[model samples]
Target chain A: MSDLTLTPNIDGADDYYAELLAMHDGLSREESDALNARLVLVLSNHIGNRTVLSQALAAAALKPIK
Target chain B: MNQIFETPMYAYSRHADQDATTPPRHKVIVVGAGPVGLAAAIDLAQQGIEVVVIDDNDRVSTGSRAICFAKRPLEILDRLGCSAPMIDKGVLWNTGKVFFDKRQVYDFNLQEEGGHAFPAFINLQQYYLEKFLVDRVRELQAEGAPIDIRGRNKVSAVGTHPNHVTIEIDTPEGSYNLEADWLIACDGANSPLRAMLGKDFVGRVFEDNFLIADVVMEADFPSERWFWFDPPFNKGQSALLHKQPDGVWRIDLQLGWDIDKDHEKKPENVIPRLKAMLGDDVEFELEWVSIYTFQCRRMEQFRHNRVIFAGDAAHQVSPFGARGANSGLQDTDNLCWKLKLVINGDAPESLLDSYNTERVWGADENIQNSSRSTDFITPKSGMSRVLRDAVLDLSEKFEFARPLVNSGRLSVPCTYDGSPLNSADALDGPDRSRPGSACPDAPLTEGFLLPKLAGKFTLLTIDADAPDVIEEDGITVTRLALSLKNDPTLALKNRYLGEATSGVYLIRPDQHVAARRPSFDDKLFRAAIRRATGKE
Candidate 1:
């Protein structure tokens, strides 16, 4: 349980990725940025455990910016 | 041995012997006599502009359609001078409950801003709304308002010129032509004018279908909205139950796509489903039923030279939120004042562009919210369904997940946050009275703030010494003072001033805050009014 649970939890990951891309189809850069911000907040609220979220954030930051 | 609630017939005797050769001209001709068209006509006539309204139908809507009237429309109608009778006839409701299967999940009060003049939502038949508006129009006509509402007059052809539109109308007697300097189309989703112009309403059409049933039943159900997701009786579908005046209950059952609409509409099929939801012991007579598939769409542009679109002609959304008619009323509210200003030469023609800008923004907001609600209610994919079910399940346990449960987002008036007409609030006032928002109505000593601020630009000086009412050609300045601390629970003061001691608010004819200052300044106040009206 302590291990970072990051291995493809969402079923049909490719379809979800396509859906995510389609959601940003018509939005401007600023609107897309705002959407990302809102998504972060909403998902953060869903994952209510603060330590788990902190661990996820740290794990995410470990990856270098492309 | 049966009695029917027949709509009183309206006599349309005025007929011009003109065809395309000798068309009678008017300042503005509004098509469709639904709530939106009548409201637009009444608002325009009140603004001292003559209008001619034409409708294909001769009576009020046959069924109880568009039953949910939001507070924003109630306030607009109040300004138009016919909200009293509507409020009396409408069933006032503010609370709603959400259920998952057999368990009650959450409830909402819509605890609207305290001291606001109207409740959040009122359930009234569309027919009663039309009847009251027509009566008001007749009374105004008798008192020398140049507004003519011709029933059974349908527009068969529409042609737009640079300065005017010539429409061919087919009447019961015969068809004739009329010209208008401007044409306001309040026609519904299947707008003939839009079709004639070849403009398509652009957006998503969902595959889900819902059967809306109105039944006349005498039951002890509370007058509140109840929504169920996969309720026990309805098996795996969603259902909604709402109360209306005259012992009518509206039940919307989610019937998945590809179902035979005619078969589902049959009493034999409808009664069993309703019986499952509301036990077989309860007797109800079927009144009306319709199958609806949600379509969230809007026109690219609302204005086309001399022709403008309002109501469902301009935009449409899913019925989940009560956004359809409420947003349409706001469309007319935004439009009539601008059209009047342009016609009377108080503002330039370019002022109309702001109406298009603001209402399109409003429509997009409504469509987005409505689409989100529809998506949550009818999850299309397996992943979406799982996530939605998780949210619903978690909503029963966790308080944080309650907001995620999107049963239906109730309609709220959209604020034009970045509108060009909104003057920056220098006083750092409260959000309620901020620029580009409808001024929060509070109980003024005279009456309510909204109605008192109608028909002209108003300068409201609150918590300050009463300044004599300023009389401008198209502006009115009224000053009233109520001690912020001494006022009743400080609701009014909080709505207007927040922590500030005194301020002056400049409001537009539609009751949107144009500008606000900590104290009165003649130069700054007039400048704000000029900018708001595009006189600058």
Candidate 2:
């Protein structure tokens, strides 16, 4: 399954992503997978950037589940 | 028995010199070293889980943003072994005075009803609160608690993966990356993380801006909260005076619907307004003055993937009631414990989803209440203002109008009613049986407090009829003959458990009742715990 990425073009984008990553760390493998499954669904629902969401999904796939 | 050698405290110490470079990676990373973030970090660390806290600021801000501390936060701090210092430093206020055109209309004492461990509210500066938390973090670390605090290092980027989260940071030295198992965003209203998640923060932004001025004054104002409904200072403006420790006072002045934003910072502009509110005869220098805008909004969801939002990032409430920071701290309290359980494998992954469900619902309620209060205080249209004025005028004379006048609303703790963690059967019974309510505080003999019996799953049975209900797990079962008498003014007593008999209540670590049953059953108790931890 693919993951999702969220990239904000506004100011403080890095800080925002850092917080998201921190939150992701708290999730379980199953929960993380479920989140990854819904990554496109959830990000597409809020942000209109398809490219960013695709990149985020690729990033999610790169990191193997612990 | 052989005598054991008493090891000195120093012998147990983990020396800082032993390679600070390869610090153990934590399960969770909490951003913002404020009260809420620190509380979450400490709670998880106390549970024998690793936590790392990062903040960009080197030192805590001395500004008195949130001066009021509620009882629930006090309880949470107590769990972290840090409440004593806070209780010792804060000024407890149980009475408040409401004024109309500089005339005292009604005086209410929060202590008139007293089932709570703390007074309805405690006034302490945010800086002191942060300091107490920092000190505790250090103390816990020294005791071998798994908590790492990195100050002056701002989070630069977050890359969330299926397994872990890589958090890039910009330190004074250079940029670095640290991977954490999970991340909790406890950052304030301008949460940088929330924006990246693509969550929409939707709500009304009040047009009226306020001037918050903190000053040291030698005046005759009593040690009571004073709120002027409609004062002549700014004309059609509201002013509030809250007494702080060591003769300092925090004054909030509503600067009308529109004013030059730039002029608010000028001492000349601010001093005149302060003089008008405090009377020209009162001598006080303007220590700090800044304009503030109130917004009643909430994030669509508190969680997305591995990232969860807490405090101001999740929601924004008007300062009319001191609900902003208090609610944020409560959010942290709720999320941290559940995260601990899931990370520790004591509960299933589904338990983490409850954080989103419960907190989002609570955020909605807080937003509604704060929005209503804001509408009442500052009516948008002329017709709304006129209606509010009429209600205020009637409230003075008509005894029936007192309820509307007093605004029964205060920033008390909120209960979660419809959470998935609550039992479906308990939903239809009395309010006491419902999950997501704050546990009722009751007096116990031996100077012991009852709410202290909470913080973990508690099976509180009012009678010996359920003697065998006690389990040796994380739950503590309190068997009592009858419900203890509680003070009327406390919301927990009046709102949740109104003289209930022989019922079982499950309290979450955040002190909110996760579930309740008419009788103690092992199945229900297990289900309640499972639901609270999101394992269900």
Best model number under lDDT: 1
Best by TM-score: 1
Candidate with best DockQ:
1
How many residue pairs clash in all the candidates, one count each? 0, 20
Q: Report the lDDT tens digits of candidate 2 across residue range B1-536.
A: 10111211111122241234653355889988777888888888888888888877756654688888877777667777887988898887767776676566667676445555666668887877877888888899999999888766687788788867777777656666777788888878888777666678888889988888888898867888877788666567677889877677898888776689788869888888788778789998666677889798888878776787888878898976678778887787778778877786777767778888878877877776676667667766554454456556544544333344423256667777778877664523456435667665655543334445645655555441565345534444444333434333434334444555445666666767666666767777776666666655
Q: Candidate 2: where is the Cα deviation over 4 Å?
A: A1-66, B1-25, B102-104, B406-408, B425-433, B465-501
Which digits, one per residue and each the tens of the lDDT, describe model 1 over residues A3-53? Answer: 345433556443453466457766776676788689889988988777777
Q: Across all candidates, what is each one's fraction of true contacts kept?
A: 0.00, 0.00
Q: Please write out the lDDT profile of model 1 over residues B1-536, one tens digit for every residue.
A: 01222644465665653444688899999999988999999999987899999998877777777888988899999999989998998998878888998999878776766687898879987888888889889989999998988888889999999989999988877889899999999999889999998887989999988999988887788988998998897767899999988898889999999799899989999999998888989988888888888799999999988999999998989987888888889999999999998898768888898899899999999988888788788877544565667667756644545666677677888898888888887887788678999877787655666777886777777766435676544655565444554456566777888888788888888888888888887778778877787766
Span of ten consecutive residues with least summed lDDT in model 1 chain A? A57-66
Measured with C-alpha atoms, the lDDT of residue B510 in candidate 2 is 71
The per-model lDDT (C-alpha) reads 0.82, 0.68
| Cα interface RMSD of each candidate | 13.3, 25.8
Q: Give the TM-score of candidate 2.
A: 0.79
| Residue B96 accuracy (lDDT) in model 1 | 84
